[model samples]
Target: MRVLIVGGSGYLGQFLLKYLLERPEDEVIAVGYTYADENAGPIDHPLTKIDRCRAFRVDAATGEGMDACVRAMAPLDLVVNCAAMSSPGKCEKEAELAMNLNVPTHLCRTLLEHNQKSEAIAPLLVHLSTDQVYDGESPNSVEDVNAPSPVNTYGRSKLNAELHIAENYVAGRHVSLRSSIITGSQPPLRPVSRPLFHDFIVNSLKGDEAVTFFEDEYRCPIAAVDIVAHIVALSKLAGKDAKTDWLMRYNMGGPDRLSRVDMARQTAEVLGVSDANVEAVSSASVDRGVISPADISMLSNKLNSLTLVSPMGWKDQMRLALGMAKM
Candidate 1:
C-alpha cells in the first residue's frame, strides 16, 4: 500500500508517520513544508529507509507543490490529513490564515480530483478534527446526534473543514475523526510547533513554583500513539467492502473525562511530585484572546457498538507519553 500523510512535520503527523512505518509492506510518503528542508532527504528511523519512506515539501494551505507531490506519489491508497492551525489564539488573531490551513478547500479539491483519476477505488481520506467543534458546555455525543457549535475560531475553522470534505468527497472514501486535545512527546524535527496542553502540564511538574491550570476547562486528553493507532485501524478498513456509515465520521477520545487542572495533578502524581506544586485556576482568570468552550469531551457510540474498541485509559496513556517524551 502507498500511503501519504500531509503535514508530516507537525506533532501528530510525525507520530503517525513513526507508528505507520512499523508496517513494512506499506510505502509511506511524508509531506510537509519544512520536513523536507529540515532533513534534506528521507527521514531516518529504524523501520524506515530512503527507498520505501520518502519526504516532500508541500503547502496544503495554498496547494503549492500539491499536484506535483500527488503525481509523484500517485495511486495512493490512503491520505491522512493531520495539518491544522490549531492554536485558538492564533486562529483568532489571523482568521484568514487559520481558515486557509484548517479549512483548505483547494487542497481537498485537489485530492478529490486525484482520487477520481485513480484506476482503483478512491483513496481513503482521513481528516483529523478537534473536539473543540462543540461549544464545550458538556461532553459531546456521537457525531450523528451532536450539532457542532464551535465557540472559537480554531474550532469553527476545523468544523468548516470537516463539512467541506464531507460535502465534496466520495462518501465511503472520506472519514472525519473528531478528537480531544492530543498529548504526547514533541517531534524532534519540528520542535517549534505549537506546544500542547499536556506539554504545559508536564513542564510544570518539573518547575520550581506552582503553575496554574484551568479547573473549569475540561477535555478528553488523548495520547498521540492511540490516535495513530485508530487512524491506522481505520485506514485498513478503507475499501469498497468498508461500512458506508462508518466512513462518514468518528470520535477518537480517551475514556477519561478530565479538566486541565486534573490532568496536571495527575501528571504530578505520576512524576512522584506533590499536587501542591501544581496550582488550579479558573479559566476566567486567564486573559486569553479566544473564547474557549468549557468542556469538549467526546465518546463515540458507533465505535463502541461496531468494534467494541475505544481509546485506552488516559492515565496509562499519559505514562507512556511521559516515557516517550523523556526518550
Candidate 2:
C-alpha cells in the first residue's frame, strides 16, 4: 500500500510514519512544514533522514506545495492527516490561523481534484480530530448520541474541519477520529522540544520549579502508540475493503478518565519520581486565555469494534511512552 502522512513532523505523525515503515510492504510519504526563519533552514528531523521514507515540505495552512505533493504521489492509497495548530491558547489568540490550518479545506480540495482525475478509489482520509468537540458536561460521550458543542476556538476549528470532510467526501472514504489528549513520549526518530502532558509531569518532578495541574479538567488520554496502531489498522482495512458508502467517525481514547492531577500522581508513581513540585489546582483558578472543558472523556466503542484493538490503560501507556515497556 502507498500512504501519505500530512504533518508527518508532528509527534503522532512521526509515530505513525515509523510504525508504518516497519511493515516493509508499504511505501510511506511524509509531508511536513516549518516556519520561515532567516537564521535557520528547515528542520532536519531524523525521520526524514531515513532512505526508505520520501519526505516533502509543504505549508498546509497556505496550500503551497500541496498540489505538487499530491501530483508527485498520484493514486495514493491512504492519506492520514495530522496537520493542525493544536494549542488552545494560541488558537484563541490567532483565530484565523487556527481556522486555516485546522479546517483542512485546502487539503481536501487538492485531494478531491486528485480523486476526480484518477480512476482508482478515492484515497481514504484518516483525519485526527479532538475530543474537545464535546462540551465537557458529559462523560464517555458517544459519537452519534451526543451533539458536538465546542466552547473554544480550537475545538470549533477542528469541528469545522470534520464538517468539511463529511460534506465534501460523502462517499465514506474519509474518517474523523475525535481523539482525546494523546499522551506519550516523543517519537524515537524525531525528538520534540515541546513536552506532552506526561513529559511535563516528569520534567516538573525532576526539576525544582512547581507545576500546577488542573484537578477539574478531565480527559481520556490515549497513548501515541495506540493511536498509531488504530490508523495502521484502518489503512490495512481500507486496502482489503473497497466499499466507500459508509461514513466513519469514532471517539478514540483510552479507557481511563483522568484529570491532570490524576495523571501527574500516576506518573509520579509509575516513574518513582517525587511529586513535591506538582501542584494541584482547579481549572477555575487558572486563566489560560481559553475556556477549558471540565470533562471530555470519550467512549471508543466504535473504534474498538472497527479496529479490534482495545485501548491501553494509562499506567501501561506511561511505561510504553517512557521506554520502560516493550512496544
Candidate 3:
C-alpha cells in the first residue's frame, strides 16, 4: 500500500507515520514544511532517518513542492491530512494562514488532478478535524444532526475544510474525523516543541507552583494511538470493494467526557502524585485571546460502529500516555 501523510512532521502525523510503517507492505511518504527549525538552519527531521518512509519538505498552504511530491508518489492508496494551525490564539491572530493550512482544498485538487490523469481510484482522504466545530452548548454532540456553530476562527477554519471535502469528494472516498483533544507522549524521533496537555498536568503535579486548569471546559480527549488506529481501519476499507455510500464524517473521541481539572486529578491518582497544587478554574476567567467553547464533548458511536474499535476511558488513556501500559 502507498500512503501519503501530509504535515507528517507534526505530532499526530509522526505517530501515524511510525505506526503505519510497522506494516512491511506499506510505503509511507511524509510531507511537511517545518522539517527543520528556522534558527537551526537545515537540520534533518529525525523521522527522515527511517528506512521505510520517504520524507519531503513541502508547504501544503502555498502549494509549493506539491506537484513534485504528487509526481513522485502517484496513485496513492491513502492520504491522511494532519495539517493544521491548531493553536486557537494563533488561528485567531492569523486567520488567513489558519484557513490556508486548515483547509485541504489545494491538496485535494492536486490529488484529484493526478488521479484523473492516471485514471485511478481516488485515494481515501482521512482528514483530521476538531470537535471545536460544536456550539459547546451541548455535550456528546452527534455528527450531521447537530449543525456546526463554531465560536472561534480555529473551529470555523476546520469546519470549512470539512465542507470542502464533503462537497468535492462526493463519492464517500473521504473521511473527516472530528477529533477532540488528542493527548499522548511525544512522537518518537521528533523534537519536543511544546509540552502536551498530559505532560503539562504531570509536570505541574511534580512541581512546586500551583497550576491552573479549566474545570468548566469539557472535552473527550482521545489517545494519539487510537486516532492512528481509526485511520488504519478506514484505510483498510478503501478501494473498489469498499463501501462508497458510507458516512463521511465521524466524531473520533474517547468514551469519557472530562475537563482539564478532571484529567489532572485522574493523572495524579493514576501516577500516585499529589494534586495539592492543582488549581481548578473556570474558562470564563481566562483571557486566552480566543473564545473557548464550554463543552465540546462528542460521541463516537459512528466511528465505533464503522471501525469496530472502542476507545479507552480517561484513566486508561492516561496510563497509556504516561508509559504505564503497553500501546
Candidate 4:
C-alpha cells in the first residue's frame, strides 16, 4: 500500500510515518512544510524511515510546492492529514492563515477536487481531529456525540475542518478521528512538538523539581504511536465494508481519565520524582494560557463491540515515553 501523510513532519505525523514504514510491504510518503533548511534532504532516515517513505515540506496553503509534491507520488491508497496550525495562540493570531494552513478547509476541498479530476486512486481520507471540540463535553453528553463547544479559535477551526470533510467529501472515502492532546518523542528542530507526559518527565528530570501543571484542565490521551497505528489500520480498510464510526467522530482517550495534574504526577512516577516535586496549580498561574474546559474526554476505540480488545494501561506507554526521552 502507498500511504501519504499531510503533516508528516509533525509529532503525530512523525509517528504515523514511522508506523507505516515498519511494514515491509507499505510505501509511505510524508508531505509537510520544512521549517529548517538543514534537514530538508531526501528524508531517508535509518530506523523510523523506510526507503519507500519520503518526507518533504510541501506548503498546502497558498498552493505553493503542492503540485510537484502531489505529482511525484503514486496513486495513494491512503491520505492521512495530520497537518495543522495546531497552536491555539498561533491560530488566533493569524486567523486567515490558520484557516488556510492550520484548518485546511480550503485545501482539503481542493484535494477532493483534484481527486475527482485526476487519475490517481481516490484514497481514504483519515483526518485527525481533536477532543477540544467538546469544550470538555457539556453536561449529559455521551461518547458518540460529534457536536463540539470548541473553546478556542483553534478548536473552532478544527471543528470547521471536520465538518467540511464530512459534509463535502465523498462518503465511504473519509473518516474523522477526534483524539485528545498527544504526547510522544519530539524530533529535532521540532520544538512545536511536545508530549504532554514526556515534557513533564523532562522537566522533572532536569531538576526543575517543582513542575507546575494545569489544575482545572482535563483531556483524553492516546500515544502518538497508537494513533499512527490506528490510522494505518484504517488506511488498510479503505473501500472495504468496514464498520463506520458514530457520526464520523471518535473519542480517542487512553484507558485512564487524566487531568494535566494527573499526567504530571504520572510523569513524576515514571521519572522517579517524588510526589512533592509535582505541583497542581491553576491555569491562571501559568505565564501564558487559556481558560480551557474542565474536561475533554475521548474514547475512539470501539474495542469491546468490534474486537473485544481492552484498552491498555497508559502508564506502560508513559514509561516508554520517559525512557525514550532520556535516550
Best by TM-score: 3
What ordering of candidates by lDDT runs from best to worst? 3, 2, 1, 4
lDDT of 4 by residue, 119-236 (tens): 4556777887777678765532345554587887778877888888878876767777777667655543244444455665556656745767777776666667667656656565
Scored by CA lDDT, what does every candidate get?
0.73, 0.81, 0.83, 0.63
Q: RMSD for each model, in Å, please?
A: 3.5, 2.6, 2.2, 4.1
Off by over 4 Å in 3: 25-43
Superposition error at 93 for model 4 (Å): 2.1
For residues 105-191, write the lDDT of model 3, one tens digit per residue.
788888888988987788888899999999899988999688789999999999999999988763779989999998887676575
Q: What is the lDDT of residue 157 in candidate 3?
A: 98
TM-score of each model, in listed order: 0.88, 0.91, 0.94, 0.81
Regions of model 1 farther than 4 Å from truth: 25-51, 188-192, 240-243, 304-308, 324-327
Tell how far residue 167 is off in model 1, in angstroms.
1.0
Model 1 superposed RMSD (Cα):
3.5
Q: Which ten residues in a row have the lowest lDDT in candidate 2?
A: 32-41
Q: Relative to the unseen true structure, what is the C-alpha lDDT of residue 302 in candidate 3, on a scale of 0 to 100?
A: 86
Q: Candidate 4, overall lDDT?
A: 0.63
